[model samples]
Structures are given as structure tokens and as C-alpha cells.
Target: MNATAGHDAYANSLCRQRVAALLRVPILAVALGACSGPGADPSAAPESTAYSRPRPVTLVGYDDDAMEPFLTRDGRVLLFNNSNDPAAQTDLHWAERVDDTTFAWRGRLQGVNTDSLEGVPSTDNQGQLYFVSPREYASTRATVYRGRLHDGRVESLQRLDSLASSGLAMVVFDAEVSADGQWLALSEGRFVGAGAPITADLLIARRQGAEFQRLPASSHWLAAINTGALEYAACWSNDRRTLLFTRAGDSSNGGAPSIWITHRGSDDQPFQPPLRLSRLDGFVEAPALSPDERLLYYHRRDGQRWRIYVAER
Candidate 1:
């Protein structure tokens, strides 16, 4: 099947599973050990300068298909996106770290999860959530929504209208708000020219007073990192100077989208060219760094449903 058809089929399957779950059906989730275990390919390996080999995350209740893992500053809390049923709405979920190798699933984040698609959560130290949802936007677009996350629940949700008014085109998703809350970076999809192949690239916008203005990609310092291929789902390191995003590639040739990182010495310097996290195998994406930058959490799809994995830095 083509990509769209395959996606639809997957959505339908998940919808059925969700219905069964709601009805108290005793369907057993696929064993996590089937994907990664003591003797599995995804089991832990020796540390390297790059990412360590991934080990599957143990999730409770919802583990069949999960992606977009984000960890809090202290690495005590984890948030990710998962679709449990045919509603096909990817809602946010959270887990608390139980130890170095496991996180106990908490549950779907209440209130913040709507019938609309929501996931890819990023937050600041102050407990504000920045995520992408397609509910209220045009069918071909998704917008960044902000909310106050308090006491483990999302509340006071609203769109960041200032960035929406910046006049970009087509779809916007996977938004990452800077630590200081003064800048934004997100994936944007649009046609390069009339009849040209459509593409997705990362864009940056900075807060100017009460509004935001999209920085010109043509001359923006980050343009170099947003290359010919699609790139999105960015996360900042603890210091906010290093950026990690997903870069797509030809899967058949072993060039599937993987996590990549770029660095700048300071706020005033331009980002250097991005480098792939080559040590971790598989189609990796959605990178989240721990507060100390020693642990990395991401999702990887290697001939299986997406699963969350962690690696030592």
C-alpha cells in the first residue's frame, strides 16, 4: 500500500483496538519482549561517544504503538504520544521514571487530550506545554497549541496565535519552544514553487514584543541544517544551544530518518552542520535529552511498530 493507504489502515486497526479496550476486551498487547529483551537486537550495548544502542521502554496499558518521547529536566517524567483506538487521535501520555531502564506508565494526560490529534509535547522549566494538534486548523495544516501543565494535568489550553499569524504556508507540526520562551522552531510543509515537489522544512520564529515573526529561511542561520530532505521534531539541550531534530532519508538504502544534532557555541553563533547519531541503529526520531545531557530518549521503527528507546550519551 501507498503511504496514505498504509496510514489509514494503521489508523483503522488502532481504532478497533481502542474500541475493544473500551469494551473491556481481554486482548493482550504484543509482548514488549518481542521487540526488545535480554537477547534482543534492541538490548543495551556498550556506551559510545554517540548514542548508545537502544533498549525498548516498558509501558503499561498502552504500548502497541507509541512515539514522540519527551523527558523532563530531571529525567523523572516522560511524555509521549500514542493512539489507542480508531478515533485515530494521537493523544499525549506520560510516564514516571522507575529506574535507569524502566518508566512506569502513568496514563493518558487528562484534559489536554481532545478528540483532535495532539502529540509531540515540549515544555519549559515553568511547566508550559507546546504541542501540535490538527483539530482546529485547516485540514492540510496543524498548529502549535500552548497550555499550562499543572499537577500532572494539562489546563488552560490555547493556540499560539502570534506564530500562526506569521504568514507561513501549508502544515505546521512538531513545534519546539525555547527554554527562555523567546523563540520557536517548527516543521513547515509547502510547495517550493508552482508544480515543484512539495517538501517539509524546519522554520524559526522569534518573539518580537507580543508577536512572532518567521525568520527568512533563505538567509536564516538554521537553513543549512534544514537541507534537501524533510526535517522536523526538534528538541533543545539543557543549555538550549544544541539542537536535535529528525532528518528523513531513503529507508530501503538504510537512510531512514534518524536523530541528528547540531551545535552552536553561544546564542549569537550560527548552528554548525548537523551530525547523525550514527551509533544508534534503526529509523530513529523524536530525540529528548535529559537535564544533564547524559541520557537520550527517542523512538525507533526498525521493521516493527514504533517503540520508545533510551540510550546513554
Candidate 2:
């Protein structure tokens, strides 16, 4: 089927599912009251249960092919990296959402010329693009680059050299933009030569007139544990008060990894102690929240491979 037709079909299917769910609410309520004991308050509201059945959202491509997906603000477009084609190297690609739960493959992004690896695409509130490239860096090192998309094309490619110096080997794996587009949360790691640190730490960079400046590390109880050495992926909450990040102990002895949450009053305030979200096992990375802030999507390594999973807040 053509792309447009496929998208229409997917949208219709989603609408039908929502209508069916709404129609069953009355019958479900009746069944619950009938099963309850006499004198029980049937009018009482039901407790909110955690989501168990995994509702898999469809993104175009094979399961093993796509990586590092960044959804647009409207959740209508997904930018990701795919290495499915044998002739072509890994490149940044985009997919358009047909409905709330379905996506169709679009095409390659236009006009950021470089043969080197390009992935980890981030979009600001206005759809400005920021991505990592190893093209011009010395010795295949990755650096952050930003550009503006205009008329279906990217213009004025510029590198963020003030963020780091040459040979520092900086990479921005994931970034989160605030609601007002004033602050940016990024997960950065500095790679030295061989025998470097095993993980990367989270950093907060605020938007100065036209550029960004990294904020100083906050003083929290957890920050005192190992102030200098802790690596994890972090994302800012919609209010920018809470930060969700993956925290792992030392990686040299195969330490356990889990998701943690830290709260702060504002972007400039200190953060509270971080608490673990899940039980210890496997490596958890890429913690992101749904638009409603009720669902979290993350990836965990099972055995030899990694799989995406979602949890309800």
C-alpha cells in the first residue's frame, strides 16, 4: 500500500479501538458491582491500577534496525537512526505518526552534509535541530552540532565548541527541552583514551541569549556519595523540577543499574536525594516520560540484546 493509504488505515483502526473501549465501560462496571458483597459501596471510584499489558506503539522498521528515537513535540514525527540498508551506513531518519499509536516511515532528513556518522537528533520547541556528528572532529570523535530547519531544509550548521574543547571526546546521547524552550537537559560523557570511565553523567545547560552554558553540579545527598564519579542518562520533567536518570554503581565489577529520580525546586536550585525506581538487575538506559507524565519509556539489556519497555508512574 502507498504511504498515505497506510496512514489512513492505521488511523481508522486506532479510532475503532478507542470507541470499543469506551463502549465496554458500562458492562465492566455492572460486572464489578455484581461480584461485590452486599452493602459494599458500588458508587465508590475504582482505584487506579498500574498498566500491565504492554501496548506496543508501532514505529516503521524492524525491531533490531532502529535506535535512538526522538519524538517531536506533537508526537507526530519520530527521528531515529536506522542501519537497515546494507549499502548505506547508519543515517538519521524520520517517521510520521498515522495516529496515536502508529507511525509510517518518512524519508532521510535533508541538508546537513557530512559522510561521517550522524545520529541522536534532538528538536527544540520550535523544531530547531541538534545532533551529534563525528565528521569534523579529530580522530573520529563525536561533537554536538545545531542548525535550524527552514522550508524542509536545514541551514547554518554550527558546532558547539564552547561546550567542550578539542580532543575532549564529548558526545550528547540524549537531550530534553523545557516547555518554554529556556533550558536543555543533556546526557554527556567524556571519553578519554583507553581505560576511561565506564559511564556518562547528566548535565544541565541553560540557554543564554543565543548559546548554552552548563550549570554547576547541585549539592544533594546522593551527590555526596561519589561527587566526581557517577554516570547515567537523565531527562527533565515538564515542570523542570524533577530529573529522571539511570544510576548504576561502579561498572568495573559489573555493578547493578537502576532508574532514579531527583527533585529540585527550580533549574537553579539544588536537587534532593535520588531514589531508585526499579529492583536491581540488568542495565537500564534512556528514561523518558510520556507527554502526560504518566508513562515512562526505557530500554533494558536482557542478555545479549536490548529491548524497549514502558512503565506507568
Candidate 3:
């Protein structure tokens, strides 16, 4: 099936599942597995023995699916986005664990405005959400917004309007909030031409009262490489000292992007030189560090499609 048709089919299936759940009916044909494609290797070594080998975790399928998944404090709930959704226009979606490795599709989390295009979901220790939205108030461009979750429901979303200004020209893809909720790290960039060039750089914003202000470029350790055209998808360590990001400089390098890590005194300080994490020739992007900082979860492209992989520290 074509991409659009596949997405529609998946959506219809999910809708059916929702209906079944509402009617207290149990249907037995739910296949939970990663979609097959060039980059998706069914034989890749499993990351952990704690989990079953060759078990497929559903990230996205059918439609041009890109998910930014993050675990909550308890690690039972997963929050992400389904870009192919036709109704909400690429809105945030959530899933909760039904068993050890199985998650039931809980409907879209409440609180996001249906009129907005929301993606890239991240959470802090306090359950506050930070995501990107192309809503009207955000000047019709991708801007970062935050909302607090109370009792599994979201409150009103508040945009970081100052970052959406013309001079900033930054499109934030992902953000990470510190455990204390005082520091925020984001992958953002300024547009150089009409097309969206992968020029995003890692930026740090500090919470000042009720607002966040961007820190100067010179303040971070990776400041030297925070240039116009070679970075995206940044994540922070639990302690907020180390940062992991993706770098795409030369198109001919490989199929997957490279992952880099940096260290700084604090969020306001400069980052050190970045070191490449994966030596594999494939493309690696969307690096998420485990809470203990011992393992890394990222998607690597083998050919046309991207597959999730876990790397041990």
C-alpha cells in the first residue's frame, strides 16, 4: 500500500481497537512488531537480556512515521507523536504498559488543542510536558510549548513565544528538562534558505520566574560547533551535565547520522568538544540516554527505513 493508504489503514485499525475496548470486547489479532524496510534489520543483536530478544517495539508504521519517545519517571508510560495522523495533524500520543513489554494504546492525552500541530513530546521529572507545535500563536512555524500534567491530564499549553521571533529563526525538534526543572535543552536552528536545512544547534534555556531565556552561544562547551549547518536531535543526561546529539555534516558520509556527547559545568556554561558515539557505518539519530547513563537508544538507518537500536555504554 502507499504511504497515505497505509496510514489510513493503521488509523482505522486503532480506531477499531478503541471501539472494542469501549465495548469491553477482546479481539485477538493485535500484532506488535516493527515494520519491515531496508534500514530495519530483524537480525540486529538485542540490546538487553532483561527484555526478550527479537521482540518488536512499535515506534511508527505505514505513514511517514517519526516518533520521539520518552519514558516517565516510573518508566511505565511512554509519550510520543504520530506524524501521519490525519485528524489531529501529527499530534502527541501516549501508551501505557499492559505487561512487561506490551503497551496498550491509550487514546491521545488530553490538554493539547486539537487545532494545533503538536509533535516531539518530552517530559521533566515533575511530569511537565514540552513539545513542538505549529499553532497560530507560534507564527505558523514549529515552536516549543510547555504544559503541566495533572492526574494524567494536561493543562493549557503555553508557547515559548520569545523563541518564535523572526530573528531567532529556530525550529526546535526536541527538548529536555532537567530533573530539578530549572534547565532546558533543545535542538533548534535558524533557516538559511527556503528548504529546511539540517542546521539545528543545541541550545540551552534557563527558567527565569515564569519565562525562559536563551543562553548565549559562548556559554556552552560545544559552543564552537554550534554553527549554522550540522546538528540536530539533542538530549540531556539525567544529571544535566552531559548532552547527546546528532550531527549530519557531509551527505556522503553514511546512511545513518552520527551521535555526539558533550560536557559542561552547568546549563549556562559552555559544552566541551563532542565525541562520536557510534563507529558503525550506518546512520544514527535520535539518541536517548538511559537514566543510569549506561545505555543509549537511537534509530539507525540501514537503507531506506530506520530501525531502533540500543547501544551499551
Candidate 4:
């Protein structure tokens, strides 16, 4: 290989090694006081839970890929993506909880699902929806969009210019808004080239009046969460103090990626180190907690299809 090609190969190999090393070290944390920023009160951090064994959730009845599970603040509604028919367009769907363990399908989301793609739906207390989709079919990256949920339908779809104008060429995916709509957490995939692989990192955006602005990457808890690993699909607890997300795990243990959870003293405080949910093994994604924070919802690949699973105390 030429000199440039040789350097690229060497860089990729180093990245792979770092990811493997990170996977071996189950719980990684930065210096205890490294994240003491404004509005941070170290003594107020929430109590951490001892990792528990979680069982599979059987309520979701999608024969296709049903991932990126998101629950509303009330926990009465569910939103996710479906791609059962590989030849057809991947779209978003919703369901209403019938009981603690059952849900009634509400069918495909209207006014949001387009011929291109739509996935990763989240909402605030006011029922405003946020999701990711391409600006156009030929577009290289996807952008985050905001819409209103009225009478069980999505309305008034519009692109969030503040985030879209962050001056990054990446595809935004899996997003969650805080209960009060003041904080936005999403993942972006930065690709190497046209046919090159993509690497993802989590980003937090704060709302300013009608627009949203991203936090400086340097001030973020990137070292603890990102860690040169593919991290995404993060959702906050009802109180916005706990965060659950997914990242690449050792393949021998289960799948390429696994579920993890972290805690913070408050919204202003950076996240404490994350701990992997060892019991929820295998190809898991879309890690989310119930509105009440008593249960967790996620999905794992089963055969050629993906199924939704949940865990409760």
C-alpha cells in the first residue's frame, strides 16, 4: 500500500484495539471531580443501583425490526421504528399502553413517515415530537426534525435549524428530549468517506428560546461516555438525572453493542461513569426507561429480525 493508505490502515487498527480494551474494562470513570461544573452539586448525585439481571420484554409485537423504543413522559404511549419489509421504506410507529404489560398498536405515524426514512422518536410533556430523517433522498446526512403530536397524529413538521446549522457533516440519529424540553440528547454518525465506515458520538443540546445550541465538545462528558467507542441511543430518566445508552461490547460476550446506564447529581452535572447492564446481554439497542423509572425497554436482534424487550424490578 502507498504511504497514505498505510497510515489509514494503522489508524483503524489502533481504534479497534482501543475499543477492545475499553470493552474489557466494564466500568470506566474519569477523575471524581473532573466534571464539577457550574450548578453541579457533587453530594446530590442519585444513588447507584447494583446491576440486576433483566428479563426479555414480550409486549412489542412487531414481526420486523422494532428498535429505538421511546416512551412518552406519561408512559402511556410508545414510539419506535419498523423495517420488516426490506424492500419497503423504514418508518416510525406508535402504540398505547393497555396495562402494565400490554400495548395496543396505533399503526404507522402519519405526517412524519416519508418515502426516504424516519426513526428515533422522542417527546416532551407538551407532546411535541422530535425525530431524525434525511432532508432529501440524495442527502448524505440526516437532520433532526420537530413536530407536534395532536389527537394521535404528528403535525407541523419542521427542521431544527439551530442544530442542523451546527456546521457538522454527520447523520443525526436516536434523540431524546428532557421532560421539560430544556435538554436534547442525540447521536451523530460521522463517516470517513463515501464508502467508508461511520463512527458515532453522543451530543447534548440546550434549548435557547425557539432554537437549540450544542454544548462545547470539550466541556462534555465525552471521555466517560464516548471513549472512542460507538455510543448512541441515550435516553434520560423522568427526572433527567439518569442516562441509559448503548455502545460496542465484546462480541464473545454477546453482540456488537450492549446496554448501559449512568447517573448524575443533576441536569447541570456531568454523568458519573456508566455501568453495563450485564444481564441484558446480546445485540441490544434503544435502551430506555419507563416514565415512572420502574422499568426499562430495549430490543435485541433475534435471528434475522429484532424484537423489543423490557426489564422490571
Better of 2 and 3 by lDDT: 3
Model 1: how far residue 2 lies from native, Å: 22
lDDT of 4 by residue, 1-313 (tens): 1111212321132112222111111112222122111221224223334334555444455456676788787888888877423244668898888765567777888888876557778899989999876544123233678899865689988888677533233456557888888889877655343222245678888889977888885246655666545677888877877788876522322225667788788766778777777677666777777777778888777766767777774
Query: Residue pairs in steric clash, candidate 2?
Result: none
Best candidate, TM-score-wise?
Answer: 4
Candidate 3 stretches with Cα past 4 Å from truth are 1-66, 84-88, 98-102, 113-116, 137-142, 150-152, 193-198, 217-220, 251-256, 265-269, 279-281, 300-308
lDDT of 1 by residue, 177-264 (tens): 7776677777765432222214456777777975567777423668557655556778887666888887653221133456777888
Tell me which of candidates 1 and 4 scores higher on TM-score: 4
TM-score of each: 0.76, 0.66, 0.68, 0.77
Which one wins by TM-score: 1 or 3?
1
lDDT of 3 by residue, 1-313 (tens): 1211212222112212221221122333332121111221213311222211222245332233434555565566666565323333566677775543345556677888465466656777777888765454333343678898654568977877655535423445557676667777776644333322334567777789877787675344566546533566677788777777765543223322456677778745667765555343355566665556555555554444444455555
Where does candidate 4 stray beyond 4 Å? 1-62, 84-88, 137-142, 165-169, 194-198, 217-219, 249-255
Cα deviation at 132, candidate 4, in Å, is: 0.5
Superior candidate under lDDT, 3 versus 4: 4
Ranking by lDDT: 1, 4, 3, 2
* lDDT against true structure, model 4: 0.62
Every model: Cα RMSD to truth: 8.9, 16.4, 10.9, 9.3
